[model samples]
Target: MKSVAHVYPWDIIGDPGAVQRILDLGVDAVALAASYHTVRAATPLHPEHRLVDARHAALYVPVREQAWGGRRLTPAEPSWVDGPDSYGQARDALKAAGLPVYAWTVLTHSSRLGDLAPEVVVRNAFGDRYPYALCTAQPEVVEYALTLVREIVEQGQPDGVVLEACGPLGFFHGGHHEKTEGGDWGKVRQALLSICFCTACAARCTEAGIEVDTLRAQVRNAVDAGEPDSVESALGAELASALAAVRTSVVAQLRALLVGEVRELAPQARVIVHASADPWATGPFATAAPELGVEVDAVVAMCWPGPEASIPGIEALRKLAPGTRIAGYVLALPPKPIEAAAMRAELAALAAAGVQEFHLYHAGLASGARLAVVREALDSLGQRP
Candidate 1:
């Protein structure tokens, strides 16, 4: 509780005036999905105004995949500035009133719904493009991403740039499958869904002389037109080598991109990442250290609570970037007393584990007076509780 109270965006449906009340309760900031990411709706804005209510919110900007406004399409250039002069303009306007603003960007998550981006999107071994992804393996993809972040930084001038969850999509065989809220990413084996097997990804692996097809074949399960799918016939030999190559290359690239920027602009801004788990875990998350040039002071881990509540990741975070402080993520969506308790527990555990920063996913915790609980937590931090 010795740090600032960080939180999410308040999506006020009917009465917009209630936001101030929410912020009054120690909800130091708001992270919002600024605009929908769609082929048609290039830049995200509320339609009425492109600028988010920055004066009242701490921004965790929700970046869209290629397409956001229903249609799916990936622009050669990132479409974040169609509405405002720059994302930083919104940040600056908000900071005028003493707010902290960071460019909150997502990583390895390019699937929208039906079909948005195909080639430039996240694809499974099956080839069906998920809604939002830009293939992490493609050099072109990295270039586009860097260009956009640089634009936001050079023009927007945010307090810091946050890279959230950077890692390869799960691994797969000859290719991969996609997963949805529904189930399996078709043709692309069930194992391939969360995993990726894009040709570009394979090529990246091949450069290291790994067998791309062998890795792809390894994840393929035997599927009987009449019987349930089984992994018995699926999976190939010599696949791990290929999978390792893809994962390694992707992580290295992300780490380099993020840290490189921080080094270039450390005095003007910071380049950081938010990895609580999965993408940020060890092996898969080998990029957290300064070797990759990550901004240690600004890099933070959203150490949230799990059913079992392990701290290996947090400890790893501390070890990965010795000086970076972690902000344990407090889930506040429903705003229930139980959730508050969980947040409290997470904070307690993380702090005890030596984490100093705390970031609460704003939307979950800032509803009505439920945010009052957050205030209680922050008051304790400020020597008030």
Candidate 2:
């Protein structure tokens, strides 16, 4: 099995010992952020500033005018980092230290772009807009994602690429000072709320033989009537199936186009997608049902929910996409105890469930004690092949 550590560009740009620290952790590669969304990240061990407030989604590399070509949804360059090419500088430094780097590209989860162009963001059933969730059903959003991928691959020049949020984001915006928990919206209601009703999505659903107005009404009624057991239960099987088909197709097309662009530009680079087997899942780990039929080198499942929940998901994905590598996106930070034995146990359980790779989350944010636990756990797992 292979292990990859996740880090932000800010973690490496000014910190001289950052690469060495990562090397000591015994990870095979680093998934360095090429484009990222808003966050106030904690650099617990950096020699420079300890906190980095990346106020918005921005590209770590230079936002070349020629590359964007006057697109209204162009990415902004991060002001927190010192250099014009933070990604490039970090990539070169990590490479110099003999660690392979993968350009970790975030696709459609940009609040900055969504705020600038509300027409491209997801609008839920009740006509409420989710500024953080970019609806991939729009042509402009698709074009923007393709351009982002092209710039990352062409500029960063990494050994591989890891694509995140490769499809439409849904209602869950974690960092928006969320305050909807009092509504007691269960899983079913949350899923219903995630259903996009934007013009493009409506047109696509119409093309799929779904009545948009009636479907939207049913969605609203379902939410109002309290949570059902599942999405299919709330919206009848026929309607749910149609909606799922349309949403899956939207994600598949966007994924295909982006992957195709990567292939054409850098055929040698390996492509790994953050994906889920569930047809209704959205956000960063988008739905990558077998029916979508796009090929990628690896698929990573979010494993932060622990082994009981995550192992089964990993198994489902394995059966769905046979012959492709399956990775567990394991968390190494808070809420998880700073203990190597516990971490190693979870990693072993995932591996037993057929996980061929491990993607450790937030190397840049974890404290030294937590990182030591990560290093020890990885050491217990033995060397990567």
Model 2 pairs whose backbones collide: none
Local accuracy of candidate 1 as per-residue lDDT tens digits, 45-150: 1224323322211112333444223323232223323333334344544455465555555444443421343565555555555444456666656664564555
RMSD of 2: 1.1
The lDDT of model 2 is: 0.90
lDDT of 2 by residue, 1-385 (tens): 8999999998998889999899999999999999999989999889988899999999987899998967999999999998789999999999999999999999888888888999889999899998888889999999888989999999999889999999988877554778999999987788889999999999999999999999999999999998799999888999998899899888999889988888889899889999999888888999987553777889999999889989888888888788888988999998999999999999999898888889999899999999999999888889433
Q: How high is the CA lDDT of each candidate model?
A: 0.46, 0.90
Error of 1 at 159 (Å): 1.1
Q: 261, model 1: CA deviation in Å?
A: 2.3
Q: How well does candidate 1 score on lDDT at residue 258?
A: 59
Model 2 worst lDDT window (10 residues): 168-177
Residue 219 miss distance in model 2 (angstroms):
0.4
* lDDT, residue 106, candidate 2: 91
Leading candidate by lDDT:
2
Q: Which stretches of candidate 1 lie over 4 Å from their true place?
A: 1-23, 27-90, 107-117, 168-192, 222-242, 276-293, 302-307, 335-342, 363-365, 383-385
